[model samples]
Target: MTRNVGGIDRAARIVAGAALILLALTGAIGAWGWIGVLLLATGLLSVCPAYLPFGFSTCKAK
Candidate 1:
């Protein structure tokens, strides 16, 4: 993975993912919160499969 996620985007993903997972554990958002795992994984890994189709990159030019 070439780090398609960066800067604020990465931070947001981590935060959102953590929150969703927490909520799910607390029985607040139901099974849908499980999707947060995807966000967390993508954020930590700095890659997103969905972005592949659009050839998108949030990472800064190196």
Candidate 2:
């Protein structure tokens, strides 16, 4: 799949993901913590399935 994440979008996702995981590990969040894992995955992969259906693309494809 093409990269649909970039710039601050990607950066924010990564940071948020990390924060969520840390918080979850500390028992700050429950099942919702899994959302962070998903974010981490999407950020690392540079692809967001949600963006596809909405025709959203943050990265300018090479």
Candidate 3:
């Protein structure tokens, strides 16, 4: 997939994802924290499915 996430968007996602994963691992967020794991995966992949239909792309055009 093309990189639809970039710059601050990418950094924010990474930070959010990492925080979620860390919180989940620490059991500070409970079972709902699994959602954080998913976020982490999507963020690491740099592909947000939700943005597809909306035609949103944080990446710059070539």
Q: Count the backbone clashes (under 3 Å) in each candidate.
A: 0, 0, 0
| Residue ranges of candidate 2 with Cα displaced over 4 Å | none
The stretch of ten residues in a row with the least summed lDDT in candidate 2 is 30-39
Candidate 2, residues 1-56, lDDT tens digits: the string is 98899978888999899889888888888767768888888888999999999989
Using all chains and alpha carbons, the TM-scores for the candidates as numbered come to: 0.94, 0.87, 0.79
Which tens-of-lDDT digit does each residue in 13-38 have in candidate 3? 77887787788789998777667666
Model 1 local distance difference test score: 0.92
Give residue 4's lDDT in candidate 1 (0 to 100).
90
What's the CA RMSD for each of the models?
Answer: 0.7, 1.4, 1.5
Error of 1 at 52 (Å): 1.1
The sequence of per-residue lDDT tens digits that candidate 1 reaches over residues 1-62 is: 67799888999999999999999999999999999999999989999999988999999989
Stretches of candidate 1 off by over 4 Å are none
- Candidate 1 matches the true fold with a TM-score of 0.94
